[model samples]
Target: MTRPLLSLTNVTVAAGRAATAKPVLDGVSLSLAPREIVGVVGASGSGKTVLSKAVVNWLEPPLTMRSGEVLFEGRDIYALRGADMRILRQRISYVGANPMGALDPTLPVGAQIVEKMRAVVPGTSRRTAERRIIELLDAVRIPSARNRFHDYPAQFSGGMMQRALIVDALVTNPVLLVADNVTQPLDVTVAAQVIRLMKELTTTFDTAVLFVSSSLPVAREACSRILVMDEGRIVEEQSTDDLVERPVYPYTRELIRQTPKIWGETVSTSRHDDQREVVLSLRDASQSYKVRKKTGFGGVNLVRAVRNVAFDIRRGDSFAIVGESGCGKSTLMRLLCRLELPSSGQILCAGRDIATLKGRSLLEFRGKLQMVLQDPFGSLPPRTAVGKMLEGPLRTHGWRVEARIRERVLKVMGEVGLPTELYEQLPLGLSAGQRQRINVARALVLEPEILIMDETLSALDQAEQFKLLDLFEKLQKEYDLTYIFISHDLAMVRKACNRVAVMYLGEVFELADNERLFFDPGHPYTKALLSAMPTLEPRRYRPEECLLEGEPPSPLDIPAGCSFRSRCPQAVDKCSRLQPSLTVRERQDFAACHLVLPPTASGGIGGVGTTVP
Candidate 1:
């Protein structure tokens, strides 16, 4: 048999300094051949990242590699000298999960990439290095590469920063690439493009990729072989097809079953929609920000973050705003909650114009609408005890009796599945899942009618996400609450939400019930987003054709007509001339696209490149 390009033989990683230290990775063995793609998948604390770090001797202090060898080209990497190891690492690149934190905040994003290339390839001319950097940036689908080359990491979105890190890893043209949950922060469309680029690299440069992610669907779509890790051990290893189709281990089977499929059995929402009371309504709602130019003369530009968008959330509706980053989902959320008054149009909350609400009315509105943010760690007060944090909100909102506040806090904590003992403990002492539950508990303390979950599940692992989803469903039914879930996870959205509004370039491109939206997307952008969603079936997956090309156009200077025309595959002359308005179709669907045929016409549902009129 041909020698494996990289191999880990009986690798064991233990925490702490003593012999009795707990093992995080227990005798985990794996191999990757040249030009091959292998995936390591597990729940959050399953030693997947630990084993990846061990492969390259990147384990930090207190996490020691005990016994076993990591062989690269038949040589033990652990046995190599410091200088030799450094040289070996040049041919083996690693891009970590926290791209923003991974990069130096002091330097420009472009400078960091250039510096890596210079450090790896000695004596390369500055002029040659710069040209190569631009090429790399362009290759990674960063729009207007030269113009944004000097931009800082803070300026880029989470997805943009991830692409920059991927470019940094590939700039050296390494023989082995180690990507650890690199696509976790990205939306499905952008993540698809990045995965497709990785696949192309394996073919173009004959690079072996060791991809580690908690998302099994992403792994199944990208990897040829997969290794399932449980508590400190590799439970099963098999071809991606076998692992997904016929897994021996229960853990592996559970993972396959838990992975959110984009298009599955349609969840019935007819029962929920029967009693329709307009809880929130957006009538020609629009939001615009006056952005000052970074360079040149000081002139203000009206960057329309959200265009003339109109939607309604009926009572107890799980309405979702699905879009990629910078697509105005959050901005619209702000508008809906009265955080930002819409520059144009009316936002009616329970038949009251929220934009005009003030003083006592605004305060009451705030109590009615509560928001749960994405980052559980950052959202919670680290120094504040869970009991104090949860009770303080009720006290501030005029719940005077101390006994009543304590009783309310404890009740909500139990509702969110958090242990009652954790009430007195600081948020820092809690696990990530526990912290998120605390966040949920904090929101529920007010007994809000409308709950806005802004990417709350994006930061969690699959298992943790499932738990939260279950809690969300349970809470929604019990409280008779309406949800406005702002997320990019299509599968999660499909499962949790009854209705979806596909946002793009600050416009509501498509709005439909979950079943029709997923199975038959009318708008091209909606179709692209659905197609980019990673699936367990490898043969059924097609990332290249569906992945959106290049980064979305800047909202600061959005194109006149169809804002999505530049990246859209089905763009025609008419699409460039005029923007399409959302037209209500049969089956209670709405789509803002010139290409989709009318609902009344024959062969209209899947007919692309056809005029509606």
Candidate 2:
């Protein structure tokens, strides 16, 4: 029998004060073989992250390992020092959940990668180092890798930053790689691309991987063996197929059930009719930005953020824009909220163009539409008390009566399941879920009819996300509100939304009812997105099923013809020469694809008889 490449023997970690400290990882043990991929999964605060850090001997202060041995290649890492320890670290790499924070913001992202690579491999020539950096960048599916190499971290989207981090980790071909929730912040399509890259790297380099994640489905997709942790203990360990098919642990079974199912599930039967009045409409709306190039020295580039987006948002309906990062979902939300005027087209609110509204009228229009940002803590002021935070919006909107404003704030706080006693406390003291609830309450305090949520649920745990979603449904009914959700989770979109629009490279590729879009997608990109949804089924879904080859093209220089042709597996000569117009195949359902046959030809989803608003 061969010895394992790495092993943790009876590890224990504790936090808080010395006398009253508590253990976060209690006597956890695991092993990994060379060329093997192992998954450590648990909810937040379950000690999964602690265990990963401890293995590399990187535990920070307040997290002391009491008694344990982290053996790599039969040598205890804690007992090594000086050059020995440095050599060991060079053979191992770590990538955390927050990709942008892991990078140096002041430097160009590619320069940082080159610096790290040269530091790991001493005396490497600059030419060799630069060549390797671009190779790794392209390997991780970053579009226009050469141009993006000179851009800062802020210039890249969340998903693009994650890909860059993955490239950094693999640039050295380390013996062991530790990835902690690297895909949690990315969209489904981007997550799938990252997972496929990891699979290929592990095989090609014979590298052992430790994948730590809070999502069981995501872990199952990327790992062969999995260890389940709960409240500082390893509760279960089994092969991926066995765990999914016959999970013996109660906690594992619960996690499997909580995983969202994208296919073969019953549709939402919420009593929202399609004949409601139109609350908002976009007529050939587009948005563009002027960006400065890196090498050209004051040269500028025009980037199209949203292009010719047209849709009708019905009153009392849940509408969603589903797409990967940098797909213009956020840009479209900004247009609807009047944060940016459309460059060429019209954004109509209540049958009037919002661009034409002046000072007082624009303020009034903003009062009717509010937005809930992606980061709850970032969006709210940390120094201000929750009560003041919620009240500020009311006061800004002209609720002069102090007593009435306080009463309304408390009411909305209760409506969002936030305890009234915590209103006087600062936001820094509250948990993530509590802060998110406060974000919702602030938006609700203004009594807005249209609420836009931009990736609001992407940062939460499974239980927290489910709780917030339930609250959204309840508030939507009580206030008769219309929701405009911008997200990348197709599973969540299927359950929470009634109508769906699939956007790709700043254009709507397909628009249809939720059931129709999920069951029988029309566009190739939409189909690829649906197929990439993570699941815990016994049989794994291979990446080849959907056949998306590369990342999306850059918005600065979108392809002349179909923007998706570069990645679409079904592309042809005609697809690259002509951009397809939005053709209606069914009532209120449209698709912009040259290859998507008409409904009559393929027995596709029949025309919806009811009108849209």
- Worst ten-residue run, lDDT, model 2? 604-613
How many Å off is the CA of 158 in candidate 2?
3.2
| Model 2 TM | 0.94
How well is each residue in 509-611 modelled by candidate 1, as lDDT tens digits? Answer: 9988887777667787888888888776432334455558777888888887888999887789988889888866655578898877555554556432234
Task: Point out where model 2 deviates above 4 Å.
Answer: 143-147, 269-272, 293-299, 537-543, 597-613
Q: Estimate candidate 1's RMSD in Å.
A: 2.7
Cα lDDT tens digits, model 2, 289-371, are 99887566889999999999999999988899999888999888888888788898998999999989998898889889988
Q: Once model 2 is optimally superposed onto the true structure by TM-score, how far is the C-alpha of residue 83 displaced, in angstroms?
A: 1.4
Error of 1 at 47 (Å): 0.9
| lDDT comparing candidate 2 with the true structure | 0.85
Q: How does model 1 score by TM-score? A: 0.94
